[model samples]
Target chain A: MTTRLVEGSAVVAEAMVRAGCRFFAGYPMTPFTEVLEHMAESLPRVDGVCINAESELEAVGMVWGAAAAGARAATGSTGQGLSLMQESIAEAAMAGIGFVVLNMARGQGDYFQATRGGGHGDYRTPVLAPSGPAEVTELVADAFELAERWRNPVVVVGDYYMAHTWVDLDVAAAVPDPPPAPDWALDGSSGGTGSAKLVSPLGTTKQRDGVGYDLAAHYDHCAQRRQAMTEGIAPRAECLHTDDADVVLVAYGTMARYAEAVVTACRTEGLRLGLVRPITLWPYPSEIVAEACAETKVVAVYENNAGQMIDDVNLALLGAAPVVGINGFRTDSSAFGIAPDVTVENLTASVQALFEQYG
Target chain B: MYHRRVEREILFTGIGGQGIQLAARTLAEAAIADGRRAQLFSSYGGMMRGGNSDAFLVVADDAITSPPVVGTAWAAVVMHHEHAAGVWPKLTESSLTLINRSVVAAECRPGTGAVVEIDALDIATGLGAPVAASLVLIGALVGATGVVSADALLDSAARVLPSYRAEAAAVNRRALEAGLATTNLGHPAWSRAEVPS
Candidate 1:
């Protein structure tokens, strides 16, 4: 495959289009603006529509509308903007309307918001955190597919580093063209025919000949759908030297890339260190992590934020291993998440210290 | 220390308007155009001019594992030295650093590494393409380092340069050629040797 050097935002947009996303709506926010800009530039040429919504709430609502009408649609912003869109996201999840949600987060602070849902509900948005531009291509494609297949919102997270980093990759080769929307999608075809489809968070419309809207019944169906989603979607991860290493570093997104470099460097020095990079944050890849980290002594959780995903890693480990928490020790205090301190040198020191104390 | 496994890392720094971002991107594109894998991360401030703009790039003949933030780089390409001190400490002992003498003070040289001082602005002025100083400096870097071939750089320039600057493509080529002629390939990016596939 021929590779063209492209920014991660362009790769996401191109990959989304290649995955058949026809409708895009987003309010411009730092890190998320470029993705919207790319989508606005690309979508129109391919007979698609891109809307610059007034606010994050509007953007998510717009995507929900498009998705309800059987269009592969998406909206995005950073963690702050995502906070505003949470209510709509939960409603979409409850309604079983499928759409992709992009969070080019300021930092890794949104781990809890992404996997656990900031919106009030027991619903969970399947979260995908790609480490680099190349992986983003495949993950973006997968985001759309998972959204359509499971009929639920899927979240893809990136950060300042991942958003700006450009890599040589072929978008066409990695992502196949998306197929038509599913038959269950609403297109107003059955309207006025007494069998009109109702796509609502409260659940589908009750049949005209049957009893009125059964809210409990709707919730029962949603409960089953949630359970089915948990069973159907498989969690994924990238493991390195975890089999025999005594110290394992667990990180995701761009932080994982730096952790991988540290893991490799420590391995070169005969240090028994390894890494567990979660590709999916929602399902948490618990079983895979538990199996891969089975032989480890210390499962060090290295998240950019303060102990967000550590809980998940702890849950995944099931206390099989001693778990510790490490921050990126961010040198940039701007809170914009510019972690120059996230270099391999700093991380290697941190990981080596774990080996020194625990190994 | 066995740093930089299969890739060569290059760091670029300059003021906001010096075209450091474009130059770094062009160099990366040129590397890919010449059949190498490249990764670049550019950070810039809000100011349109005179703000800090730094870029970290890695080019490899195979899959690249080095993170975008390199603790030590193989080289540094500096357009202005005001913001280059941060990168100077990150340069290795054998690193090849290029400073645009036209704007940067000679005393701003890195503590380690061989320094090549070029009158990039002067060269661009001589070529009548005054805005092409960054391109000239990058071209001279490729000429000296062989990070990418001059021809590939020219092709990448044609592809990446804005449409409004299309008329200046020939001048860019001339500027690149002039910069290339300034250096003799003393250091060829890790002995100019082939990597094991």
Candidate 2:
């Protein structure tokens, strides 16, 4: 296998292509822009179509159209751009459209936006928050698989760190086993036949000649599918020193790496600090979070934003442990702009102060 | 010096046009070529000529889990005096710092790390590639730390050069060799890596 140092966005796009993502459309946004750039360059080379849509709304609509036509498709933007696509995303979820939506976010401000979305309905999308470039490479294929498996939009959340960083990766290694076929997709083969299919935001009814609208039944089916996903897709997480530790720090995305390193260093210095990094942010990794917090005294939820994911952490713990929210948001005075102060030293100080009072 | 399974962070700092990002990338790619894990991050301002530009690189034998912004760098390559002030404070006492004597007017604090000042611009100009002063310092980085072999660095540098700029490849090679000849690898403050048991 040939190893090459590559930008994370380029590698992630390659992995998506390998995982059978044949259609991509996105608008330019910082951090997320790189992914779109790579997709535009590489997708057409693989006999796939990549579009630089006029806006985020157009991008998601394009991806929805592509997914409806039986191609594994994707679209993404920064969290700000994602806000504009919420209606389309919710529609896709309700309609059982399977595709990947990437939130190459600016920071961890959008945990609630990704997990508990603004979509108006009893709908939830599986969100994967990868901590670094390597994880992004691995999760791209899994995101696609999970999307198709549930026939719902799967959101992969990352930030500037994951986007701009260059790491050594072999994109080939990231392609998981091919997902099952989309037999239910819209193909124009049986257009005139009575058995011709219909794909819509309204759930399909057993009527070929008449327009059947069954709101109550469709809602029931959507609820049931969401329930099945909750049970079938086990939450994925990484636990370090959680089994026997006094304190457990809950973090995700790029902030998770900062916490991980600080935990290792704290352990070296005899603090008994551990970390719980939720790889799959929704499904929320509640079970793993609960398990890691079982024996710990204090659970610190560190996020780059102003205390978003702490709610999920608190809900997961179910008052099993006291939770403290550590806000680590920081903005660099550069053209690169704002980001979290996700340095190991900064995190270590936060941990030490927490221990000084609560140890 | 170098030890396997441990993370080493290097910060490259200079003005916007100084090739700081490329130098950091070269070290990172060289480490990867030698079967090591590496991550390179670049943060720069909007100004294309004279603004603070920096790049952070983490090299490790195993996966590097550190955030893009490092707390304390193990090593640093300073290319200009303009942005060096802010960089000095982020370094720990044991940081292995190399300054471009051709540009930086004052030396770093005497007690901080093992400071190696090289006239990189002068060296590069003598080799007929003054713009490749960054490569010269990168060569000194390999020589001082032995993090990766000089040959590995040269190969990576050649590979990373854009196709349109291929004409300067020979001079860039010469600059790296000259920088290597100027530095003595002994008395390195940074830990050298060996395969872990």
Candidate 3:
């Protein structure tokens, strides 16, 4: 594959298009704006439509409309805009209409917002966090497939660092399986056929008319789909020297990249340290984390937020080891923007202190 | 201590409107065009001009494991003195320093890596395109570092220019060639570098 230098946003948009994404609607926000801009530039050439929606709610609503109409559609924004789109995201999940969601978050502060969405339901959004630009290409392609597979909304979580970083990568859509068709999708073909199709969150028209649709039964079906997703889909985690390390650093997204560098540096000095980076934040990769916690003495969770994913890390560990939150809230306090303050030295100190105390 | 670094990192610092972003991107594109793995991460304020602007670049013959917010850089390409003080502490002892002497008047420590001061602004002014000073610095950098070829940089520079800015490609090409002639590093860092399979 011939590598080309491109920013992460371009890589994501290219991957989405390669995955057959035909409709994209999003309101512009910092970091997330680039993805929309890229789609606006690329989609029309492919006979697809890209809309710069006036609001995040409108964007998600447009994506929902497209996805219901059998189009590979997507929308995105940061946490601030995503907060406004939560109701529609929940509706998409409940409505069983699949679409890709990009959360180019301001910082890691939106981990909880992504994993445990503000939308009303017992539904959980399958979230993937790619560490760099190269990984984003594959993950975005997989995200489209995963959303279609479970017939649910899938979120690709990132930060400004991941959105803005450019890398030399061959961004071709590589899906493992042939995606199943959206037979349930609504099109004008069903029009004037005396049997109009219904794509609603409550229940299908066929179910309501034929089986006397039960609301509890529909919710149960949604819950079972989630359960099947948990059992069927394999969680991806990148482990670095976790087999024999005394301390394991738990992180994801860009913060994990920093943790990796620090762990590599410490390993050279004979310090037994490693890192566990969750590629899928929602599935949580509890089994792998539990295994690592069994071997390591201390599990330090490093996040750019104030202990958001630490809850998941704790749940994964299940008291196998002491879990500490190294809240690396790196933000530019001036503009309420992101700051690159998670340095190797600071991470090294956090792990060294834990190693010294626990070892 | 062994840092286990395989990538060469370059940090570019300048004011907002000095074309630091474009220069860094061109360097990355040139590296990719030459079959090297490259990564560029840029940070600047929302200001239209005269704000602190910087870019971090990682060019490697193989996969790069270094994070974008690099703790220490292999080189610093200084285009202006406005934000040079903040970038100096990140340079290691073995880091190369290249400065535009016409615009940057700050004194640079010489104990570290090779320090080469090029009169890029004067050179660009002489070439009749004073705005392409960053390109001049990039040309000199490629000549001194051998990270990419001068011809490849010219090709990539033309490719990166927007459609509206297409009129200035020839002058930018000339500036790059002129900057390349200013440095004397002949051999590339690696000889017989196999084409990545």
Candidate 4:
């Protein structure tokens, strides 16, 4: 098999198919729209069902329902659409339904109500942010495993840049063989004992309490599983040139790639600098970051948001290493417009200033 | 092992609806088919139709250090005058600027490189396919740079243009030959190296 160049969304859709995702439901959103289109076009070829829901809320509900019925199910949306799906996602998390959710993230919402904590409350979701096309393919495969092993919802978060960008990928190595869904799955359960009991959320108070207690127990169990999964799959926070480095540059998602370039330039200029790229944004790899900070003088957290990931980086470093944030916000409506040319020269200057101020 | 060096970056500039991205993709694919590492980055801003659309490509044997092509480029294909003027500052001594004679009347740098003016619209219209002008331009770029083999380009056209493969293949071949036969305006020959592949 030869490696073919494929789109990022197409890669995710192909991974879903390989993961035995039999049910997909989502609303169309820019960047993320391609994910839905790909599933619509390719899922049916493999006898999977793709549903374009009326809204993001409905889409999440549909996936929750399908997953509860023991189907390998998935859905996707952008930041705004994801907000609408959070209620359902919270419910799914409570119900122990395993599935994947993709957030082809755009810029953060400008409105106050739609800010960083836009959702109902402070709840942590396991999020994997892919920097490039090759990473997108690999992360999707890993996401499926994480979702299934933990029996919880796994999020594959990509920004507007990542969704639209095209990179040369060895598609043959990326394409995974379709995994066999369990006999409990909807597609695999058809030939089973026709008398299999149906699982429902509604019942008598005693039965409901029993179900609720069982779900709570599962959630308690899930909490442990989530921790183990995060520890096991804690994405390696890439530390480039850190051995003799004085400054540590911390970034995630697409920004990490840019930061690495900046780190290389700084090293050439006789300044010892390194980069820490957090692949798993939710877990944030605090321990790894803390260990790096133990040696470094200062850590600079760079992000597209004003300071979303900065807080986590600060928490990770604690007070061991002084943390500075080099932050920018993309105010453009289009995905391409969002990526303003932050030159290496400018970044190097910023890193130097941070070193003087906090070193 | 065969290696081709593409030091100068090439940026394909055009309007959003002009199929500029497709042309870039085709070229990048052809380069890869010839065993060269290529990166294609297409930028489509807010406007879908009447907005500025551009694609950046870095083709080289070595790993690309910087993805964006900032100052100068080896060549540029401007579908219109506005695009030509917008990217003119990036042209250097080794740059070859190909303009559609029907749309732009820009002057080229003296003794820098040859500028081949072609009425691509007229030729495409004569062929009864105006949209195929992108393929025509791609052919011209191949003829001018000889970065990838003519056969590999045709194969890329067939691979990408799935619906109208036969028509696209024929028109692209003709356009490639037409471009190769065009006068060079006194610059050195820029043709593909003959290899026993």
Top candidate, metric TM-score: 1
TM-score of each: 0.94, 0.91, 0.92, 0.82
- lDDT for each residue of candidate 2 in A1-359, tens digit (9 for 90 to 100): 88888988887788788888989999998888899999998877777899999999999999998898889999998877999999999999999998999988877777888987777888899999888877775698899889998999999997777777898876354443344458777777654556667777787765445767687889999999989988999899999999888889998987888898888788878889999999998888888899888988899998888898998898898899999998857677662434625678778888998888788
lDDT of 2 at B60: 81
Model 1 lDDT tens row, A220-244? 8888898999989899998999889
Output per-candidate TM-scores for chain A, rounded to 2 decimals: 0.95, 0.94, 0.92, 0.83
Q: Score the docking of each candidate (DockQ).
A: 0.62, 0.61, 0.60, 0.30
- TM-score, model 1, chain B versus true chain B: 0.92
Candidate 2 wrong stretches, greater than 4 Å? A171-181, A191-195, A206-212, A335-340, B1-4, B105-111, B126-128, B189-197
- Candidate 3 regions with alpha-carbon error over 4 angstroms: A171-181, A189-194, A206-214, A333-337, B1-5, B105-113, B186-197
In CAPRI terms, model 2 is classed as: medium
Best by DockQ: 1
Native-to-model Cα distance after best TM-score fit, residue A9 in candidate 1, in Å: 1.2
lDDT of each: 0.85, 0.83, 0.84, 0.67
Global Cα lDDT for candidate 3: 0.84
- For residues A1-359, write the lDDT of model 3, one tens digit per residue: 66777887888888788878889999998889989999999888788899999899899999999999888999999888999999999988888899999999877888888988999987888999998787886798889989998889999987788777898877444533324448788876564547777777786545536656577877887888778987877888889999998999999998899999888888888999989999998788998888876888899999888888889989898888989999966575224245556777778888889977999
Which ten-residue region of model 1 chain A has the weakest summed lDDT?
A: A170-179
lDDT of 3 at A83: 96
Clashing pairs in 3: none
